[model samples]
Target: MKLLRWTPLALALLAGAGTASAQDKPDPNLARNLAATCAGCHGTGGRTVPGSAVEPLAGADSAVLMQKLRDFRSGARPATIMHQISKGYTEAQLELIAAYFAARK
Candidate 1:
């Protein structure tokens, strides 16, 4: 009788824990989605064709990429389009993007 009474409570608690765990984990697709914007010009996965005018982002140094992104965001870097695009991302999102591209190679 006690086990039956406790079963529903235990199930509810377990369900609640699953919900909390899901909420606590960042969305796996978030970084990819955020980085997708860059693909229009940066090339897919930041891999540009050889001899392209734009620099390939794949395997870029993370520190340099982050700094460049920060500069664009802060208006320290002059850009034809990146300045505007960079403004769209939060600092944390930019960090995720930097990490994403830096790992692409």
Candidate 2:
């Protein structure tokens, strides 16, 4: 009788545990991590050194960034390497990257 009563409670707890663990946790630093890949050319915090030919991304408008990235991804923009590079990121990742840079000063 004791086992029978506890079995239901145990099963319920196990099921709840599985459900909780199964839910995916979004990374808090995903945008930063993704944007880190651009630091080489764009510079840290999206701010390039003065007089650098590569345009600074810091403080750029998100709409413009999105349009530019989308263009590069779609091959509509003529870039020696951006087109190829942008191809590697998913649409959502691209959005995150653009937003991340847009937020930086």
Identify the runs in model 2 with alpha carbons over 4 angstroms from their true place. Answer: 1-23
Q: How many backbone clashes are present in model 1?
A: 0
Per-residue lDDT of model 1, residues 6-101, tens digit only: 999999999999999999999999988998888878899998877888888889988899999889888899889889988888989999999998
Instruction: Report the lDDT of model 1 for residue 16.
Output: 100
Model 2 lDDT at residue 47: 94
How does each model score on lDDT? 0.91, 0.92
Tens digits of per-residue lDDT for model 2, 1-105: 999989999999999998888667778899999999999999998999999999999999988998999998898988988998898999999999999999988
Model 1: residues with Cα > 4 Å off, grouped in runs: 1-23
Best by TM-score: 2
TM-scores, in order shown?
0.75, 0.77
Candidate 2 global lDDT = 0.92
